[model samples]
Target chain A: MTEASDTLVEEVQARFDDLTILEYEFDNVEIELARKANALNAPLYKRRAEVIAKIPHFWALVFGRAPPEVETYIQPSDEKAFALYLDTFEVIHFEIDDPKGSPRSFSLKFGFKENEYFKDKVLEKKFWFRKTSDWEGLVSEPVKIHWKKGQDMTFGLTDAAYALAQAKKRLPPGNTDKSKERALPEYKALADKIEESEESSASFFALFGFVSSWRYVSAEESGKIRQTEAENLAKVKRGELVEEPDSDEDNENDEDDDHDYQETEVFPGGDEVAILIAEDMWPSAIKYYKRNHDDDDSDDDDMDDVSVNDRANENDDDSDEELDIRALVNKGRKEPTSNSPPMPPPARKKQRKA
Target chain B: MTEASDTLVEEVQARFDDLTILEYEFDNVEIELARKANALNAPLYKRRAEVIAKIPHFWALVFGRAPPEVETYIQPSDEKAFALYLDTFEVIHFEIDDPKGSPRSFSLKFGFKENEYFKDKVLEKKFWFRKTSDWEGLVSEPVKIHWKKGQDMTFGLTDAAYALAQAKKRLPPGNTDKSKERALPEYKALADKIEESEESSASFFALFGFVSSWRYVSAEESGKIRQTEAENLAKVKRGELVEEPDSDEDNENDEDDDHDYQETEVFPGGDEVAILIAEDMWPSAIKYYKRNHDDDDSDDDDMDDVSVNDRANENDDDSDEELDIRALVNKGRKEPTSNSPPMPPPARKKQRKA
Candidate 1:
């Protein structure tokens, strides 16, 4: 490989490796799909296989083993673009052809559109990349990529970048350390507590499935959103901010309003993430009920003070920052907290997330 | 208690016992919820408790033993109605008032509406009853007793009756059979097959969950529906029935049209059933995919002949009647069989049953 090609390969490999970590968290779903392939719809398995094939180092990154013999080649098309081939199948085309003068602007053409599984589903497949220092102000952000002509199909690459950075942060701090070891001490402690509790291992697995399935935001972003909301709630309880007028009446006007706020566009393999969550998250979901029940028992006067302090404490705990399993497991109880802002009613109508 | 009240209690107990059997089929879900109660939403548990409480022999039937010390009193409100009091709380009011003059006509008023958990949610709480000869031509159908003004919310009594009848059919037959034994040899054989197969016990539990959660129709009705569809498909293959013009173009006009065919209303405790299915069914679902795959391998010419013979043999096997778990597990491979009818695409959307 040439010098430029080597650099490109390294960058792609790094990103692919990070995604593999996320994929590991969702291994239960993969196993389930593989086992149940015969019982499930044929088209579903086809779709899943197609997505897995798109990522580089698929087996090594996902299964933590050497991949089968698969040849890959990088051919430079022009000064602004290059094509990436996997086993004679062109997977992606990277292009820096920008009409507007922007900093390090580039676009990725996901070239597997010709694959039978995706041919009819995807019209145009491309993702745009732009640099931004927003993740802890330490890493660059990639813009949401738009694909499919006349469609609002986009996925947050910024979220993916943030997720990867967060995963790296979990490793023990060290320069020039490329060990596969992840999962901090705090995470281990949390898992231990879950195991020690009356909850089954299914709950723990379910929580992992839920985390891996978050598509609109990265695990880091989801955690940040929860933390921010909790902090805001604490502030409101402390009389630092006034509460907005309730929107319950407006929400009642639209029975299907619960779906209105969901991200319309999804990333590749997003549907699979949702399927995993649905299949695995039920046992852990019981935590929300328990928290709500506990909240219901405490006197309203003292409960508010306790909740506010709890929220504040959570914000300060950096070790348990990203994708706080405890918080995610308990977040559903927010509806019952006396001082917490009223959330919209739970969706009465069943919604099937694809 | 008077003789009439004794008879009423016996009747209620019989039906309640049948329901408890159905509940036992979904025991995995109950245990999961109970274990993870501290992690789940409080309202969910409250709702579950309420449903269980609605049945007269809830404690005795579920625990398979005597219940806790609780007072219950029956008082006739009039010749046509009676009130049932449990621990100074009116739980149900049985009324033999039917303006339509239906045979064996009665209504049950679930009197716990005033409880805080149910106050805002249940606008009307009543169930109607009518005589029916459907279950071996021998039972009565329950109707939805319309109590609330401007509301006609009701559930199918026939479906419930059919479900009870089907459960009875699964039990070994003998005169004066009062042994607590359920599950005929065929059921045991199926369960043994599942246990011996590559699938986990969870998958077996999940199949039960799926069967129990089906709304709009009873287990018997669901079986009948599938059988009818299969027969229709067979006729279509035989060129006895004309095919409808392909509606692929119409379906393309609306991508979100899939949900239009789903049943809008769900049975009570439907959500719990769905949770069970997601948590447990993955391993067994593989059988369907495997069957479909095998079917794909066979040539189209003799495949039809093989399928017809398979279907004919299946019809002859009386022991495999009812919801054959093996057939349900292996149904996905229907494509290769010429006599097998085509099914709609699998539901890709994750629908929360409740």
Candidate 2:
């Protein structure tokens, strides 16, 4: 309505008219997660409402991001089980717990689907933005918000939340204890999925799953450390990980060497002594037991490595969003080089065995 | 025919016509345990090749059964799984180290259908039988087999022995493993109608899929145990578990009147630790926890007085089968009635989490 503002808007639109908005990072993850938490709660009784509330918060701690809004939820009307719609989101937002909080962050997670899962999954997007920075101006720009429909199987506080929500929707909410009678497959499937993801990665974050305290190593440092490993393995073959340096009588040059079977100061933090491991472990000893026995052998080492990396990513994502069941199943699948087992999405979240 | 031969025929039928067939033993339970021994080889491959060999002998160890005339086995194949049927045959003519070699075994196994599943399953039969002392007579009986048309969800196995004479015209001999793999499910469905009779009592034997090493309470013990429980609960509430005996000094009844919680054990097998136990832990807890949550004056009872006998028969019929997928979402499912969590069947036999 103001002449000055209209004039400014016209100028900006004219300049960026040719710019195409292909991707958008919406702080929708929170909304989406809450939506699912709400959906699963539909079948639960009011007294069991705590189950629904506890689920997402617990997952937000584990998964890294809370995306996927429920498209639909099918509950059996019992305390046993039901189904959920799962759509892993691209944009992730973490509430900035600072004094000047008026809507905080929106960060685009950069990772691509291998094939046609999305048109430009791997193509980078400028995700990070602060709501305070001309946030209204950015909204005017054409942007693409990622959306899809899918299904998942999960359990826990979410299951309780889900049951409670349903119960509240149908009846009235007070104190619900129906959570104790939580469904079977949902709870079990959730446990199974978490373990599977970790099985693939064994990241310090994944380790935090069973043991509260955990250790973490930076992703980049992990790679550098491994490069040193190959060097050490070669040297050991030639008699070298430990060598007598010219500087001393001791087997020196140790300071120049990197750590082996590396450890991290940070891990899935639960106050336990759990250690964050590298992604490479998936293709190695953790899954090596099966590959060594397999009649098939090839040069595609990348496939095995995904199992490890995915696990860590899963944990990292937990700190940012809700868990993704399909992605979790994909973590434990046999290396794709060997016909990867059935679409892992059928599996729940991956976790370590207790 | 000589007159003397007529007398001999009578003797032969008396000895061979009737057979003492032993199926399963109710006294013992067979829990299929997954072995985590990396040094050992999985028999899955060998069993796959011998399409008509005997079922694996592991069932005997699982059920703690004496080796009968036959055994049951489970084998996963290249594309599917096959539950094998085998016989403990006695071949009298064979000899090895000694002149009296206990008739060696000669097993025969075959595949059949279990459901409407097609590509979801594959079928083949393998046997592992012991040699017999009455081989000539056993060979005299011919097996008659048939596969009713239309319905494609069942099958059976019968041998040319035990006086089933002149029945070999129904089916053809088995072929190679590859052929069986190709024919499976389809042929299995075709053969679904081959059972001789459906006996209701025998269904229980079939319902609990055979695995090796489970320990179930003996039927006699199970019944008595349930009955004892019913009486105990009633007595507990009345505070009348002990009765006053006449002609006794005041000191005489004190020891016996304290409580029966310290007396005989009630669990399936925790005889040495005769601790007090509720008839069922979970349900009882649910009832008690909910009811007494408001009552603060009930008792200042010790935790030791809390019972651990809850999980006993809650899942007696179900084998307490919990689905274990590869996730960490909801791993530790507590068994309320019992102190210990319910143990799930192994995920993968050789790679079980210990």
Candidate 3:
């Protein structure tokens, strides 16, 4: 390239870089917008939770009418667990205002009455807004659900994941390298078991065991790393430290492929499912509850499709539809809809219409 | 249903209705959020436009690298017009603070140097946020371009649309009914010509002739209708006027089908195209301009795909890539990229990779 052309190229690049800084400013404004929205929404959500608590089977029916993204992950066995014990569902945007964290970080909490299914009164799973060298988004660690004998709705996926987590916890602190984690006996056992298991239908209960394909980093740890990186960048600019271009190569070696995750093991599409529940299902719980009534008042076609796996859609207006009997003794429905042997609700009904 | 069950249903419905009010409140908060963000962004965008104005062929390269939603509309002929004299483009959200209007309403202004395509130095199209009885969205009227002899890029579509608009303007006041409008000679002529024409590709220039699938009502007219509706509803509640169940039926009769819009005449996906330009193209023009440079700096694969219809992708860094020769006589690029005959830039290149 000629000197004049090179000079022109540099001028263009300078303007482009300036615009990138502006884009960063735009992103900061977006983050502030999210914080404001979250603050305004918190009180509204609290009031909604209070109102929904009075309606029996509110969470159960809400799950039934959830948008397909969430519905697709639910299996028949999970529906049975939900019908028996599910009381209320709540989503918390726990890091909306944290400068070091992200607005996308949230926790999904499920309240359940003591039932034959599990011992826990509340199960909470948290997804953290995290960043790796090349990627940035939500990442979650597996949650352990202590299931009763023969009541493990996820088969053995959750158990395996939990056991692996315990074993990893015992590893030397800095040995949390993914290749070393994969080399653990517990991790191998889980991987082999996942391979041996048939390609069976997934249960929503399996979602509790989801681990993001991206390496999981706690928000606190990520914040520390970011602080150090910024400090080092400043130092390098001041000639106090040499810039290390090879650092990226080190991160690349610990790539996600080290996990060797199977589709079922990692819970495919889990992030989308979590987001849909947090943003749509939780906020629109009343609409979903009303849908249960709409389905009853509208047609027998909607009512007839409730089977074991589809227990979420059962004309639960009767026994199953009632809020957990022990939890809401006086809130049961007076009359369940007409009798219909339940089958699975029609899959992708809207897509079929299109 | 038993009376007890009926009472239960009513209770449920009451709670559901309360939740709907909350949903409406949520929507209001969203509107306020948009207002706040737009205020913050206004100055940032103004500064950006100033920086970009100094760059040569900024608008042309930005349009070339625009997302597929906008790119799909541009044809070879339209690209030639853009290459020749498309000087600068601006998007203004003209109704951001209008109490009765919407933030979605905007005007796209194109400042062009003297060119063969048209006589106007500046062409502007405004899309208004409108509401009909059944629909609410952005709608626009066709713009007339005084084409220089033999330079009409839309192949008569714009002429037909503009002529129809003129004819409609002459209709008796309060006789703007669609059925009557379609009865006009110009309307039928366009419809018949549309029917007889073979399936032909479209030009982006033709988008200036877009009409919404929903009936077009001016923002002022819509505001008046809303005010009158509110007054009527209040009068009915006070028993000053009897409620009319047939009002909706009257609206249904004036439904969109009365216009009998063919897919091409109304311009399929015009609303989407308008929104993409306003929200994406205008804001991200710098990223797009950088992409043109990236294509040149990278490899032969990206630079070799500029054809007549694809003139936007031509390595114009030499001649066409420079700012319109007359507008910025001294602002020409020093070196154009390596030469190869340009084909239409690869269609949906990203999708092809997938």
- Clashes per prediction? 27, 107, 12
Predicted structure with the largest DockQ when compared to the true one: 3
**TM-score of candidate 2 against the unseen true structure:** 0.16
Q: Write the per-residue lDDT of candidate 3 for residues B1-354, one digit (tens) a residue.
A: 366654564455445444545665666776788798788888888878787776656687678677887887777566656755788899988888987777778999999999767898988888987764334677788898888888776668778888887888898865646777778899877666556543777678777887775555665556755565455445533434323335434344343444445433646567778889988888766656655544442334333322112224333443433333232332232554332112122211111100
Interface RMSD of 3: 12.6
TM-score of each: 0.21, 0.16, 0.71
Error of 2 at B324 (Å): 31
Residue-by-residue lDDT tens digits, candidate 1, B263-329 = 2111323233333222222112222222332233233322222221122322222222122222332
Q: In CAPRI terms, where does candidate 2 land?
A: incorrect
Instruction: Tell me which of candidates 2 and 3 scores higher on TM-score.
Output: 3
Better of 1 and 2 by lDDT: 1
Write candidate 3's Cα lDDT for A221-259 as tens digits: 567556644554445334342233344343443345435
The DockQ values of the predictions, listed in order, are: 0.01, 0.01, 0.14
What ranges in model 1 sit over 4 Å off? A1-227, A236-354, B1-34, B38-354
